[model samples]
Target: MKIIAAGLLLMNVAFGQTQLRSLRAVPVPEPSGLSEYVRDKASLIRLGKVFFWDMQAGSDGVTACATCHFHAGADHRPQNSLVDPNSPFRVNAELSTVLFPLYLLSDPRNRNSAMVRDSGVRVGSAGTFRRIFEGIVPGQAAELGRDALDKPEFMRGDMQVRRVTPRNTPSVFNTVYYVRNFWDGRAGRTFDGFTVTGANEAEGPGVLVARNGGLERQRVRIDKASLAAQAVGPALDHLEMSYAGRTWPMLAKKLLSLPPLALQKVAIDDSVLGPLARKEGRGLEEQHTYFAMIQSAFEPKFWESSERLNAAGELDPMGEFTQVGHNFSLFWGLALQAYQSTLNSDASPFDRFMEGDSHALTPQEQEGMRLFQNAAGCTRCHNGAEFSAAAFNENGSTRADSFERTGVRPVGDDIGSGNGAFKSIGLRNVEFTGPYFHNGGQSTLEQVVDFYRRGGDFAPITGDLRAFAATPGQTAAIVAFLKALSDDRVRYERAPFDHPELCVPVGHEEDESGELKPGDVATSAAERWRGLAAVGAGGNAAPLQTFDEMLRKFGENGERAHTMNEACTASLASLLGR
Candidate 1:
């Protein structure tokens, strides 16, 4: 009788029509561990929030942490969704399939991995890996120059077209629950996944060093687990936040410039840049300005205070603080995490039905759920708590794995599946995170279901599940269940943002030749120093390289430096200049 009931239930689910109802999102809780810091000490999480919202930290003040991540419901949108072309700042604001780098902060508790490089650079070699390093390689810089040279118009100092980052910025919400970060699961263990508590610590040992008669590999114990170890990578990534192209001294110099009150209040490593600049007999004040600018970029309150002055009440502040940057970073990280923490889609009608809520799911929805678990093979990888194992594998390639193909072309090196194979995502908020697939090829939910129904994304016939073989009616039922996962109440907030001031201002124009506009400044303190350093370091150093030069040297060489930095910085300056 039980077996008969189960089969009947499946049949009803498949055949019945169901009305879609909206689900309310559970309220998210605040982050903990704030009071643990010393008296009046700001928690890293708080700082992260402030930093996330502060757009001044970037070259264009208009871009904040929210700019990329957007709201939790949106899945850091613009990923294949297309952007408003009329917008001057962002020509194409698509979400990437990869993650970017993070900069280093002078927290005493943080440590980083030693730069490791193998003598040989081979593509597609098994067990081979590559790590981004601090120093700009000659080949890389030259390529950047070429790209700059090519896109003279949009690539100009004040009007850059941002490059599509290698990876998509994952939603930082609920990230705390995951043990790892990034598609490859490389960053979670070392840095407490994103908390400032571990800010001063070194990265986990996942690297191997090979030298003459000496090859030692250091493996981290944390990698054995998943959820507890994923937040560490963003702390050191160049593309995400940490210093890219610039060095510790450069970053330190920027930090030291914050107002003295700001500087003394927080305990950053003063020695990294201070002592080095002093020893070199270089004026540390410029470096100080750089740091101050970075702080000012993030924290508006820290910059506005006039505490560093004499009896006459002159506003001659001593230190520099990008206070806005720090606060927003903490804020965004925590808020996103907070929301994500509450992202329990377990209460779906389908789940309630399983828990004896007879009215939880309509007949059609129940059939959809059963089909999802059984005949549809949807539950194969999309199972468990998150509906995904967070593991990477070919969901059956569009062609070889199945007979049907959706005509979606495979991206570069789509070799079956590899370590970086896209991790299976939970379907909790699947509706909001389209266009679907790792590369985001499919634009609609029906299209996605159709892709699977077709057995694979591409053409050529083979494999057991080759013909998704589902009738049109069955496909509709499954899609209906998928649609039920959408939660509309999850709102998004657009935070205000501005640009950061660069050390040396540069010229810019919107014309095609990448030439400087009239009234545009030509030099910056950073540029001067960078030029001198380049020349002193044996490269022909020009105080300012044209946009054309920057792109060619950096863009095409596969170095993928943030090409938009110069333009964003210039744009910020223009706004401030106004």
Candidate 2:
């Protein structure tokens, strides 16, 4: 009778018993022995939040982690999102206000059909300056040029016009649950204090060579901190945030001396930093320096020097100072992780529905959920409480070990992880995160549904997408379900989601050849850095809201409004007009 009941339950669920059983939010583990390293978790989170948004952390003193992830933890800017036309995954060649869906071959069913010309959308990217390098490998130091410091190359010439990322930016919200990060899963689960390459592949000693010539690596074992692992990638990434030949030590040295969030204002009532602001009664520049904050957050053993004084009583710059420089990278990584770990948006309508509030979801949304589980089979890849198989749960305390080829593009083009296998990202805030997929080929959820409806554009489709077939109404239902996943806390500035001010780059100035000139780079940097220096000089600086907040603050004019709802409506209207 028990066996029969189990079979009946499996029959009732659309995605079968296995998938239904997988859905549940797992609590993020607080880093063990964190208290030994950090004076207080809240203080560390506060410091981390400041560092995450601080433009001074970048080599150009402009880009921040928040620069690419300001809008609901994902990028929203459309300009400079275009990729090279010759790229195998290239969707479109033209730059326009609107991005169209990916072009399909003549026969919609044939995955290998020559894609239609002029049919792809512009990919989203972080607007960053360029560094000129003669012959530097990706992970090694470059031979510094004579003008490396003074006249450092700033996104000039034909090759350096728009700083577009190769892949679309994924949201950092709820990333603590992800076993690995990045679309390619290059950022591993085990952070080895330095590289994203996990324990097995990382080449460096895990120990922190101390200021007193003592080495320690086993003192802290930060497990389940993939977000910390992911935080270290973009700092030195030439395309994402750094100039050519920029080292981790260089970034560390610059930030240690400068004020945190030097380019942006901090709100007086910021949830994390409110106490600090209240005590100081001043903004970021006046209240605190990165050095002080780092010292406050970490143990003195990590930063204090034990070097013997010389005859002139001057400490060696290269000897004991190198340990402090290395400590900066460690603090940056772990602190960012500490801040981002609190970014779990688990209070969605769907969450309420799962918690026994049947009426939490509207009838349409419930129907969409039903379709997603059974007919759409979205749960095959996007399962569990975070709505992704890539996420870890308490019940299933194992690293997510699956990547799928969704047949979005040809196998030959950018064969990530051997034949187009991309990590299945969590879909919690799918509505706000536009230009979906690794390539950003689909501008709207409707297009994504259509792509699945036609069984995808590529051959050898994997997961439940192999059998996916949805009507227009069903697709709409699925989209409605996805919208229900959005949390109100994320929509509003509240608690953990509430953040300090940011001066995100909107668009870049282009030269005649469509390359970014040095003036353009300086102008972009200046725009972000404005009011930063003055804040230290007792100037009243207003906090800069994100692009989305600014858009909603001003009337939702065509130029300002870039929400998913607006984009979807425009896409539907364009389709109808066509």
* lDDT top scorer: 2
Question: Per-residue CA lDDT of candidate 2, range 359-381, in tens?
Answer: 87899898999998888777778
TM-score list, all predictions: 0.46, 0.78
lDDT of each: 0.33, 0.60
RMSD of each: 18.7, 9.2
Candidate 1: Cα lDDT at 306 = 27
Tell me the TM-score of model 1.
0.46
Residue 393 lDDT (model 1): 17
Model 2 poorest 10 in a row by lDDT:
528-537
Q: Candidate 1's residue-wise lDDT over 154-230, tens digit each?
A: 23353333333333345444343333444444443232323423333456322222224332333323221232233
- What stretches of model 1 exceed 4 Å from their correct place? 1-45, 59-62, 73-159, 168-170, 173-177, 188-243, 246-356, 391-420, 458-467, 491-578
